[model samples]
Target: MSQKSLLLTAKQGSFAVGTTPIPKPGPGQVLIKIQSAALNPVEWKIQAYGLFIEKFPSVLGSDIAGTIEAVGEGVTGFAKGDRVLNQGTRGDNNEFSGFQQYALANADVTAKIVSSLSFDQASTVPVGLATAAVGLFNQGKSNSAGLYPPWEENGSGRYAGQPIVIFGGASSVGQYVIQVAKLAGFSPIITTASLTNADYLRGLGATHVLDRKLSAEQLKAQVSSITSASIQIVYDAISEADTQVAAYDLVSSGGTLVLVLANSIPESKRTSDRKIVNVFGNVNAPDNRATGASLYKQLTRLLENGSIKPNRVEVLPNGLQGIVDGLKKLQAGVSNIKLVAHPQETA
Candidate 1:
């Protein structure tokens, strides 16, 4: 069997839609007939900047939602035609990657798609949700805050009355963090974003949405006014140098500051007591697989009950080829909306 895919023909080269053999699921995996695949900034960065991949003819995509086409050996609890969503892998394993009509997903981290969401909406969940879940709930200081996951026993509302701050509240990952913080019982959930998105962010559980452009001093004063209690958790979804600096400055002693990108905060500004943890957002990674599996188990209920929601999606054109164009738009920058493509729609 063959499938259409968007391929990077060379290092720092143009992407083209080409035919490739459809991948069959290995043991413990399932073949997904992809309905929707999302484009992320990392995808374009990999091609234009030649990062995270050394192999030519790479297939780059991470978020995927579709129906199970075939089940592999020992893969129970899932059957052909089941609606599901998962994170796609790249570089080392092209067969497990998205941006193609069919890809293999380990059943462990794949979640069933509730009737409430379309494939496009479900496609937005894996990467963003994983980033938030691992950073806040993973019990490891190296990459997370080491806090209890709300979906676990006696975990919901555990942080009630405690203040939590997040930068980029309107971003895909930040929105999930706000929702997760609400479940964890964090009170006075504050975030930074454009004033235009304040209401939407508030609807997502953010109590306050300060202007993202606010100077560090102004944001500090605003946060101070929201609560006298020290902020114990800060998730910086943007993680630019300025944002990291401001986020770090806002962290209370011993509080954890979660960044999505590499630490860029200057050494001179660092403090011994405050912690900065950089999250590797891909849940498929070995270190994060268990948490990823746990999150997947609870994901369906979370979406069905409205406890968690998907990012709004903007569908692109030309199926797999549309992904080629969408990556350029992602490189330009996007707001809260995620760009999604229907790989099976390819010509």
Candidate 2:
């Protein structure tokens, strides 16, 4: 069988809608007939810099929502026609990527989509939620704060009265971080974003949403006023050099600074008292698989109960082809929205 997919024709090449053979699921996997696939900054970076995906004619996407088209051997909990969402692996083979009409997802990290969410909303969950979950709760990892997961037994509200500052709170990952931090009982959850996003971020569990335009000094002063307790954990979802520096400065001595990108803090400013971890958010990665699977198990309930919410979505038109323009818009910048495409509607 054949299906339409948006292909990165070569490293640093243009994206194009093209036909590819639909893949059958292997053992422990299920084939997904993709309904919606969301774009991430990483996809644009891949095309612009030839990063992660080395293979030419590759498919690039991490978040998808769809229905199970077929189930492979040993996957018992899921069957054909079940609505689900999946986190596709970066640099994984084409059959496991999300840009295609049909892709295979390992059963362990796939979760059913609750009735309340459209495929667009469910499609926004995987990558953003995984990045937040793995970055904050993956124990024994430098990339995480090693905090107890709230979804686990006796883990809820473990950090009551503690404070966390998430840079880029309006970002998709930052939005999930705010929600997850609330579940973990981090008091006075603080985030930085444009003032326009304050109410929305607050609704997502952020207690304070500071303006992104603030200077590092100004932000520090504002954060200091919010909590007297040492600010121990800071998640820099933006992770740009300036944001990293600002975020790193907010971490109290002996605290951990979590970044979604490479550590850009200059050595002269770094101190032994502070630790910086650049998170690799892909759940399919060897280090994060266990946590990813665990999160998937609890995801449906989390969404159903409104404990975690999807980012507001803007669906692009033209199906897979629409993603080409979406990528450009993403590269230019967007706020408080996830851009999604309906791969099955490809022309």
Segments of candidate 1 deviating more than 4 angstroms: none
**In candidate 1, which residue pairs get closer than 3 Å at backbone N, Cα or C atoms, i.e. clash?**
160-185
lDDT of 1 by residue, 176-265 (tens): 999999999999999999999899999999998999988999999999999999888999999998999999999999898999999999
Q: Tell me the RMSD of model 1 versus the true structure.
A: 0.9
TM-score on alpha carbons, each prediction:
0.98, 0.99
Worst 10 residues of 2 by lDDT: 89-98
lDDT of 1 at 96: 85
- Please list the Cα RMSD from the true structure of every candidate, rounded to 1 decimal place: 0.9, 0.8
